[model samples]
Target chain A: MASSKAQAGQTLWAKMPKANAELFALTYGSLVTELVRDYEDPIEVNAQLERIGHSIGVRCVDELLSKADSSNLGSAVTQCGNLRDTAEVVSKVGFRMFLGIQAEVGGYSQDQRSFSIYLQENPLSTFVELPTIGDEQSSSSPSGGLDDLRKLKYSNLYCGVIRGALEMVNLKVECTIVRDTLKGDELNEIRVELKEVLSDGAGDDYKEE
Target chain B: MTVHAIHIFDRKGKTLFTKRYTTTKQQLMQDAEQVSEQRKLIFGMLFSLRELVGSLTPEGGSPALQSVKTGAGTLHCYETISGLRIALYTNNNPVMNTLPGARAAGGESTSITSFQTALKYIYSEIWVECVVRSPLYRPEDIQVDPLEGRDNNAGRFDIKSTNFEVKLDAYLSSMPWFR
Candidate 1:
């Protein structure tokens, strides 16, 4: 099953439209820099990035659905039987098709309500490093301090993207950046918890006869 | 084979678009109320039938409603992963229904697979292109037209683009059962 999903992701990645990775990275970096400068708080900048990502995610999901169909992946890409399937698709196919990167799904909770996505390489943070002030450990500093460096989530946009895309498919999920390579972690990880599965009310009016 | 109409519905059972190929004067003269009522009735029946079929199937998979045949006509259904349902209503051939063995007598039998393929083609090729990709199309916004207020559920957000209508008509007219 893992191999098949990986193969699917590879095939989709090949078919995807290509863009200059450097330019994309630089543009995202400039946007984050501007947000940090304007907001003057790393936490607020994270929230703003997520808001922007939510709008992008809502529109990208439709494109993803149509692209999946056009790629001839058929039912495999469309119908996700369980949360595990959804996670695998999001990591292997979703990330690959969108960002042209491979991510692994692991760390499933015992209740099967949540899982973690481990991304070895984040395209958004290719040339990014959290700036730290040497010997200035003051907590009162509004910007550029070791304290603010730890609070900044460089790739929080991915969390919002996952949340918004899943909501469109009636899966209400909460995604958070649990681990970041920018924060000295070996890999970046996004933790996703299934909050609720929205009912489309198809059987609401059905009366037993 | 004669196609009477085509209807598309969103996941919540709201009518997105309904195109009736009015052949006779009787059908052409169907009032707005009658048409809207018919759309609601068809959707209700489909929803109930789908649930019934899903429950009755021995296999542990969703068995969606494929077709419904009556004395007058037949209804073929195809639903996408996004929960969009597209139904085609066509006149049934009396000769084939009377003698099941005579289905092979004609080379042009309206098999379920062919209809399913056609419906999927309409979805992936026509509907996705014309309606989904259009910048002006907003699926969630409900229009406040007083004329369609009689049936609130009939026209929530219709595919009212002239380009979409022209393409859909052209594709359906090219089908074998259109006439």
Candidate 2:
């Protein structure tokens, strides 16, 4: 009985059922499709996508905390501790808890306020092709320069989620997809930069201003 | 301890999914309207208590509310930092419900924490798999219709995620304390 109970605590992701990846791909595909159809400008599409992502991030963070309330989580959520610990939890815990992805947290800033989460295995790209030369969508830059990507951040919403969730935890941070395989980068990396930590009883003041 | 039901809510006080595992004699589990009424009251009461606890904190004194108990077992509530609320009201046997306390405190809460953790696991994993990940259901906030009438479908709202139900049932039955 004890062994089984122990197993329950450890059976984190491997034991849990996997979400239908096709469904995830198709879902994202449909969302992008809707955004494209609605907005003429790709910049607008990116903003809307980020907004959608922010809402999900804010909620998904709650879901993440709800599912696993560990001692580390208590500190991490209440008053976020050191930079490394916070990034480790975000890269490791957040991904595995939600998508069963094991990401490596590294590449810290000189001041220790920024870091990159290397997403080696991302489910979002299983069906998504990398943006490359000769991709002939109107949204794509006519010159096909790097400027094309300036308009569309394909997975900006995921980054938005991280930012939104961090803000909800009283940690004001900026999360952006610095590198993406979808954008011809060798790997996908999420760069998180700490802006400020909203301290005790000062949350409303930030909102009021 | 017996968790009679699990109610999941969004940050905006919307009911995402509610699953009742055990039947209670006090509130007829089979009655649709009565159960809905009870569920709503439970949501309201829990929400109010949570807000009160957060508000009543002396300026700069920030402790939070965990659980509330009465003759009707205990209401173990776990609120996420982002304001999502999940409440589990159990009607365990007298011994399992032994020495009920006014609030979720000390040792009783350790077990509750572990259980809540497991429940959280289910929420993030199974529920996300079956509910949120579904493109058809929503990528937006779930509409929490306070006035949406109750249906006969298990005496409440139906998210129709059979996979979630199956996984949750399997997990609960595997637990030694589930009885």
Candidate 3:
């Protein structure tokens, strides 16, 4: 309870009961929808959402770093160096701390272009229902809508955190949410690809400066 | 240590901005200049103080090390061209350890106090200070000073010792500038 209290004060999901995960997800979705509708500027909304995500990422990074005992041993140096290691830490630490889910780190590609983290179950995202307002009702049935929601891959929130934290380290990465991975599957897998454009250019300006 | 520069892009993958700051004032200034220019390419900047704090991570040494989630120092930065949003958040509050008092206050009874505490720390102390002081923002544009209200079910507790959620609806609703 003390740990929960301490963590609650710091994390985005603080005070969120286990029963309320679905509600929180729905609220999160609705908030995004509302922001998009009100702003009507994809750039602004996306940027704002990314900014929010970035902040969360920064906080999450702190949490991840603190939890790095010998049991979770993977070189911090390597984790700090490559995006793959960082992604592993993100999925592992993110699930353990926030979602109460244990995520498995999957294979890393040879070129290091892509890596995967698989969540056996996402309790936080389960049972989320996007409140259908006027006009959106008849277009899709609840089951179909739920399926669509289930297909929602990646927490832009976590993506923002990863992207932002990497930026703090001066690593330019292009993060994409792979929705296909979230489809009917036993495990919820997210594939994070490090953008080639920036990776190729890494350390170029820093060395010169 | 290798200093890596991260290029920030919009959702469309357009290179809207990039910045790299070292411990040196010269490098910080240069990075600030680059960020300023990029801000012009993007819209105005609207960021919380925490983002500014997070941006200071690359400067190196104990300052950067201490600044992580446990540091007491303030982080501040802004891109005027990016719509000039600034954030100032600290990971250095000892009050978080005293959740028993907060918890004893109870959810229903202490809801207002909890919300007030969160606002006091996050918005007023961290956010507003950064905004008012930033060169990017006009004082009059802020409109509401220290937006405050209560959060009913907003609270998070974990091993990390952080759980304070102040509803941003009033602040969001009041921000005529925020589209």
Please tell me which predicted candidate would have the highest lDDT against the true structure.
1
DockQ of each: 0.30, 0.16, 0.03
* lDDT of each residue in A20-134, candidate 1, tens digit only: 9999999999998888878877889889888877656665676667667666776557567799999998898889888988899999999989999999999999899776655
Interface Cα RMSD for candidate 3? 13.7
Model 1, position A183: C-alpha lDDT score: 81
Docking quality class, candidate 2:
incorrect
Evaluate fnat for each of the predicted models and list the values in order. 0.32, 0.30, 0.00
Candidate 2 per-residue lDDT over residues B101-161, each given as its tens digit: 5234445555656566665666666665676555444433343333354343333334663
TM-score of each: 0.78, 0.54, 0.39
Ranking by lDDT: 1, 2, 3
What is the C-alpha lDDT profile of model 1 across B1-179, one tens digit per residue? 48888888877776777877756687668877777667778988887888788789886676878899999888999876567789999888522334345334445645676677678778877887777766655556534223475465453445674377788888776655566
Off by over 4 Å in 3: A1-23, A39-48, A66-84, A129-154, A180-186, A196-209, B1-179
lDDT of each: 0.76, 0.64, 0.41
Please tell me which predicted candidate would have the highest TM-score against the true structure: 1
Q: What would the per-residue lDDT of candidate 3 be over residues B73-141, giving only the tens digit for each residue? A: 222322211122222222223232334343554346342233233323333333323432233432112
Candidate 1 is scored at a TM of: 0.78
Comparing candidate 2 with candidate 3, which one achieves the higher DockQ? 2
Q: List the residue pairs that clash in candidate 1.
A: none
